[model samples]
Each structure stands twice: as structure tokens, then as C-alpha cells.
Target: MKKTSILNKLRSSGLRPTKQRVEIAKLLFNRDKTFHFTVESLGKHLAKKTTTKFALATIYNTVHAFKKAGHLSEVHLRGKNNTTYFDTNISNHHHFYDSETSELIDINDNEIKFDKIPKAPNGKTIKNLEVIINLKN
Candidate 1:
């Protein structure tokens, strides 16, 4: 993503285009494929690319803000460890998680099928649906 476009996106999202934020945005959107990262991992990657040492809280807050602004998606994991990962691809999809390698592979929405889906109770319908298939040896 170009600097101008990134700045526009931030502005549209009600985020100030600070130096650190601009740098972070560049690293995030200037890619050919979607990126999945945790706060710690993103901080480490940013440290290598730039001189400023971003605090964990800053990265955490920024990531959450981006998600709130609909720029990224959060993948909720339910397991013993329950580690959360952020994804740049916000479109509806599923994932295959390798427990041994701590890896998450994208599963397109068309790849899965459910023979029977339970009916929603009352007026509360299924707003969001996500499936995580855990992999094992």
C-alpha cells in the first residue's frame, strides 16, 4: 500500500496518522497475501524493520482499533492454550490449525459443508460463524 492510500485509510478509520502508525501500516498492508500475526510477533517484525521499539500495549491497542474499524479480523481459538491471531483477510472463511506447529491455514468458505445445522432459538440468529479444524499427527 502506498503512503497516501495508507494515510487516507487511517484518516477514514478515525486514526491519526502518527509516525509509528504509518510505519506499522506500511508493513501490514504492503503485501501480496494476507498476514496472520499476534501482537508479540508483529512487534518483533516491526522491531527489525524500524528502529523504534513498539510497546506491546501499543501494538495491542492498535490492532484492536484496526479490527474495530473493520480493517482486520480476529480469529478466536478455543483450546488449552487459546492463543489469538489476527488476520488481514476479513472475508468470511475457516481455518485449519496445526497444533504441533502452531500454524493456521486458510480454508475457503466453499470448502466446508454441514449436513444439518441446528435451528436458531428465538429471535437470536447466528450473527457470526467460524470453524477451526485442529490438526493432529
Candidate 2:
């Protein structure tokens, strides 16, 4: 999407069109699929850029705001510090995490289906179900 279009999207989503937010959104939504990123990695990536320089705190704030506005989702990976990854797909699906490379791969929804949901002992309904199939080299 063009910068103007992205800015319009942010505004339509009730987010203030800050330069940092727009830059981050462009990165997150530029690709055809979702991606996993760490704050440190993102900072380092942004640091090398001249046009878009975002502070670590600003990245966190923008990410949180986008998440709150339903523009992104946070993935919780085991043995990792609450690493926040954005999902532009915004559809129900699973993920395949390559442990060695720490890559997040999307599994198509049609490729898998559950005939029946397993019962939860505590009478808790499943709000969302995600399968993170860990792969080893």
C-alpha cells in the first residue's frame, strides 16, 4: 500500500497517523503474510534506516495501540519473553514455529479442521485455538 493509503487506514482504524506508526504499519502490512519480530530486532532494523527512525519505546507503544485496535495480534511463544508478532492475515489459522530458526509459518485454515473440540474440564469455552507445531532441524 502507498504511504497515503496506509495513513488513511490508520486514521480509519482510529489511530493517530504518526510517522513512527505509519512506518511500522508499512513494515507490518507490506508483506503478503504475517511475520514474527522482536523489539530488539525491529529497533536494529529501524536504526539502519534514515527516513524512519523509531525509538524502542515508541515501537512498543505503537504495537500496543495497533493490537488494542484489532489491527494486530500477539503470539506467545514458549521459553521466550512475550515476543510480539503482528498478524496481517487476521483470520483463524495455526502456526508452525521452527525452533531452530525461530520462524513463524502460517498453516492454512482449509488444510486443517477439527471435527469436535475437546472438552475443557473447568467449563471454559475456547475463545481461540492456535496450534504451534514446533519443528526441529
Candidate 3:
């Protein structure tokens, strides 16, 4: 993504376009498709790809901020160890989680069918329903 576009995104999200943030956005949004990732992995990725080193905390902060601003979506891996994953594609979709490979593949919304949805507790409504299908192979 161009600098101007990235800057505009940041501004629209109520975030200041700092040098570090711009670089991060460039790496993230410039890609053809947005993939799922964690802050730890993203930190490691930046370490290898860019000369500008960002603190691990900074990456975590920025990622959370982006998610809050609707630039990303968060998926929780359910298993022995639950890990939080972020997806750049914010559109409604499901995911196929390969536990062995630790890879997340996108599944279109219509692919999954729900026979029934339970009612939410009183005074509250289910905001969003997402499914993370775990795969062995």
C-alpha cells in the first residue's frame, strides 16, 4: 500500500501514523491477501524483513489497536493451548485450523451450516458467531 493510503487508514482509525506504524502497515496491507498471524510471529517476521527493529510490545500494541479499529479480526484457537490469532481480512468468514502445521486457512461464510443456534442469555444478544474448525490432517 502507498504511504498516503496507509496514512489515511491510520488517521481514519484514529491512530497517528508514526514511522514504525507506517512500516508495519506497509508490510501488512501491501500483500495481495491478508493472512492470519500472532504478535510473536509478526515480531519475528519483522525482525527478518526490515532493518528498523520494533519492540515486541510495540507490535502487540499496534496489532491490538488495529483490531480495535476494525482493521483486523481476532480468532481464538480452541485446544490444549488456546492462542489468539489475527486475520487481516475482516470480512465475514470461517477458518480451517491445521493444528499440526499451525496454519489457518479461510473458509467462506456459506461453506458452514448451522442446524440451530442457541438463544443468548437475557439482556444480551450474540454479536457475532464464528467457527474455527480444527483439523488433524
Candidate 2 residue lDDT tens string, 80-127: 444656556567878888867767788887878889888866967778
lDDT of 1 by residue, 20-50 (tens): 7887788887897888887777898999999
Q: On TM-score, who's better, 1 or 3?
A: 1
Q: How many backbone clashes does candidate 1 have?
A: 0
- Give the per-residue lDDT of model 3 (tens digit) for 11-61: 867778887787778777778886788877787778788889798888888
Residue-level lDDT for 119 in candidate 1: 82
RMSD of 2: 2.3
Decide which is better by lDDT, 1 or 3: 1
Query: What's the count of clashing pairs in each model shown?
Result: 0, 0, 0
Among residues 3 or more apart in sequence or in different chains, the pairs in candidate 1 whose N, CA or C atoms overlap within 3 Å are: none
Q: Rank the candidates by TM-score, best first.
A: 1, 3, 2
Which residue ranges in model 2 land beyond 4 Å of their true spot? 79-82
Off by over 4 Å in 3: 79-82
